[model samples]
Target: MDLTGPQLCYNYTSNVIGPGELKTFKCPASIEGRFVRITKHTVASTALRLCEVIVEVNADTCTILDLALNKSATQSTTYDDGKDHAGDAWRSVDGNLDPNMPVGQSCSHTDQVGHQWWQVDLVRYYHITQVSIQNRDVVPHRLGNVSVEVSETNNFDIHSEFYDAKLCHYYEASDVPASTLLILPCSDNIVGRYIRISKFVPILYDVLSFCEVIVEGGDPSCIQGTTGITATTTVTENTTDEQTDTTDSPEITSTTISLPSTCPCSCRGSIEKYYNRSIESLLDELREELMVSKKETASYTRTLVSVDDGRTSSRNIGYVGIVLLVAVGLSIVVPDVVSLAMYMKGK
Candidate 1:
């Protein structure tokens, strides 16, 4: 319930999010918590609104995997028709199944120019067993006649464009419906780093769109089976002392559970370090400017004090000049006869 204390497992500081933009943050390790809390730290006049927040946990088993989750994905061409929304390729493997393409902002779309395809790079070889796809709910027919192909190398050529990779499953026009989850299993021993859903045959005004794509499989080189540990619980009863006036006896219980060191990862894009660097640089610049301003202010103060001292010296000299002038005028008006006569006799 509290932001700090034992309940708090991790803290995340976010950067600016643009309008209609989705930002993702990935934790380095899986954190187990009862609730996920979000709080704003900036002082801005705008309101804080969250479109969605998704938390993904590890799959049940250690053998199977979601290999394509948040992996590198690309499309042939993004759908662009003077619209503010996007049909980016990364949306397919973003682990979001919201099929409403228009407002959901979770589906991937391609232009209706020619042959369209969306591909994900697994980064490593995996013996892919099955691929799950969710079609766009708005226009379900756009995902028909798609071929799920796998290849170790993604290099395409004139002859055998998919680099002669094996086809996992091909879906005809009537195979899948709108907003439906289709599970297509590949042939045995289909090992590759790239999985592509493509429509190769040229058709006029044909576009490709899908909500989500999940690639599940095991490591090609290593396949180690994992098991989970069961939790154990112990209960103890405390007896109340006769002298103490407590009526009920309290029960104390403790449980021991072992968590997996590593969990199935759906990696997300992180800007944590980027924000950290920006903030540090900003503080350093502010400190340097503050020091410069302090020096300039001190120098200006010294200059003002020096000017005042010069004015005071000039005023004192003026007073001495006025006194001499008054003495000479008085001697002219009424002469000092005794002192003058003495001075003349001495001369």
Candidate 2:
């Protein structure tokens, strides 16, 4: 171990400890060396106080998990202009490895041309060891000439590939089989907060589409000295035009995602901003609450039917309740459905 070298096992930046107060720092990864040295720099020479130091291996280092499942994802564009949101980018990390589209509705698609890309934010830096991707069952050749990259920053351009990133793997023409899951192992140094798959060279009907993406790794650490919370989140953006009829529209909650954890300091406000600004988030809340209300209403109706004395009255009440529920559901649902359409168009 180079004590005076630029590399470090860990950096401590917390406040000084008082008497009888113990401070612990955990290294992100295992650091194997012969000596464990502690150094403190001060402007002037001073007496040093000593306390017992303890070193233990982090159990999390041995536990490898999918770091990209249900995390925030974005792509160059939604396929077919978000007609039914069947080609949204969040589908790749939804833990569904189905390679079929429309039938399975499990894939992230982008517009034409090989200049498109899709990415997932891990919310923190991790030593990414492997990336598993599933190709679409139909026209699997469209997913050619792609590169899997990792970066610590989100400074990406839709039309450009200029960024501080490392190339982990590149798949040239027919590298991955059709309707198959391919797992590519990355280098040990392939550690970053963002894992992006980009295609630069154009081919026949070149488009970026994936059914699922799984990032496996462990030994995570905060990025940029900021402590961030990690959680399962999915953000959907509908670009469909507004329409008056809501009966034939697709369900907005088909791709379900839960709310994230409390405010994470290391998120850099991007995740929080997305949830607050996205109309889909509000629609999700409204739809979930509506479902809960519908269930409760049905339960109440069941209870009333069970306690009724007359069969005729019970049948009449049940029929009336069903009609009323449908009416009320339409009355509230139609307006929001229209609003969602308009919101998507506006965005």
Candidate 3:
């Protein structure tokens, strides 16, 4: 069996399988497909058989989401055995895992050929994680070296081939087993809208078959939204303190003052002139106080000099009075002496 859309999706092949044995195949990447087919190569002769076919989906993690339920499916060819049909691929994905019906009702198949394929279209892009395929219980060994691939473009031109698709997973003869589901995980995180399953090598037969294909992943664009904040600035010419708006704007608490027009040319010059005039007036007051203090000091010195001269004159008058008293006593004593001499001579 082969899976394809505009590009090749997958290819299935194997050596051989025992009778009444079942198997599975898985894809590593989530594959979106619009078509699925089963056929044979021009040089090989082998028929395709399938008990059922399944497709699943997943998101961010490894959890599986049933995205293929009731989705559209198609095949390249159907078996002439009047029992199986191409729509059986959809019934296999309808939550039915066991094949207890008749042999024709149990699976889907195609005529013997080497270039047969099957495909499906997911209609959108998803972050795919894993794909699983279940084999039919009748003849599962036909799916041996199967390759599964995915792509977004639908360029299935015969001349160009399906060159736009990328390989998601591939299995060899040793990798296929009997009576078990095959699981493939996408290690490289492959993303696409179309999934294709195809068989490249012919083993027991050139047939490609599967019971189901499941895809799982999350939406690539289901992210949360965020809000952002913006800031604004305003500029104005010839603005004053009174005209400036402080609400919803930065505050200006203080400002510089200019000199009044009635004053000097500049505020600094006016201030300097006022300071010089005040200093001169203070200096004149100090000079007047100093002159009055000097006049008082000179008057005090002259009074002290006049009082010393008066004391010297009073001391000289006292010496002259003592000399006069001594002269009067001497004159009285001389008269007494002359009288006494005269008395003696007369005796």
Candidate 4:
């Protein structure tokens, strides 16, 4: 498994692909990024586990936007232009320009909720792929329709355009696969001047909800190609003078093993821990067997000692006489030591 893209997402092979084996789905990689909050989302029906949900983004390069109050691009007012927004009623779908957004004017919005959006140069962060949003809006906002627009004109703002999302590209539950990973690719490491992420309805209906937008800089799900295979060659000596014994010669045995299928999304980690624990248990069993052998050897040694003590034969009596002689020698040494000390003291 390559840990290059994401530690979690990887190519998974099913071992039982032959017959009526059940199919399995792999989890997506984690993305870390900035967020906007939505308060509503319903309980998911899929049994798949999301190991961890994080949006990844390079902050020094991302541009944000909020249209509630911020504006972008302003220049010398030209009311004489036939496209003046003040001259006609602006519809939600009509590309209208506010007086505040001229050709050179730029603004920023720090929402009371701290949703800071970039008002000027919205194109700085345009491309997006794989959008995972959590509708913190409490209940599904009945946002059956949403519009995503891309414009180069700096005259319009995104806030006045939320309901105006008619011309923009957006997706719905019917259009998007439910309870599955949403794939978006336009969010790559791209550079642009304007990007507008507008939705028709906030996914949250009653309460405010948090929605996560994920833009992939690179193929976060790309798996590295399997490396080349390398096999070591064993050199065989034709003959050897010390070959009198070949009883412990090494042997090569090959066994086929099937890969195990674990939920990478649900459980994050290596299966080696399980394998190591098993090997430890086997080693412990072997140790127990060795302990049993040591006990048997000790029991045999005790039997031999007992048999020697009970023997009345010549060998046994010879040992007994040698022990008695040792005792007499010790007795003689004790008296000599006392006499030597007494003579030295002239007692």
- Give each model a TM-score: 0.46, 0.45, 0.42, 0.23
Tens digits of per-residue lDDT for model 3, 89-150 = 45434444443325434344445565555566677765556666666665666566777777
For all candidates, the clash counts are 0, 0, 66, 50
Give the alpha carbon lDDT tens digit for every residue of 179-219 in model 4: 23233334222222333443333232211112222223222
Candidate 1 lDDT over 171-288, as tens digits, reads 8764467678778998766768899998853665568888889888876533332223345556666654555536655443555454333222111124222222333465667798
Q: How high a TM-score does candidate 2 get?
A: 0.45
Residues 112-214, model 2: lDDT tens digits: 6647888999998777777878887788866777889888898856655637777778877654677877778886545678999988636555678878887
**TM-score winner:** 1
lDDT of each: 0.70, 0.70, 0.55, 0.33
User: RMSD of each candidate?
Assistant: 25.8, 29.8, 38.8, 27.3
Candidate 2 global lDDT: 0.70
TM-score of the candidate numbered 4? Answer: 0.23
Ten contiguous residues minimizing lDDT sum, candidate 4: 87-96
Runs in model 2 lying further than 4 Å from the true structure:
1-62, 81-85, 201-204, 220-347
Worst 10 residues of 3 by lDDT: 222-231
- For candidate 4, the per-residue lDDT at 18 reads 25
lDDT of 3 at 307: 78
Pairs of residues at least 3 apart in sequence or in different chains that clash in candidate 1:
none
Residue 35 CA displacement from its true place in model 3, Å: 39
Would you give me the overall lDDT of model 4? 0.33
What stretches of model 3 exceed 4 Å from their correct place?
Answer: 1-64, 84-89, 99-106, 159-161, 201-205, 222-347
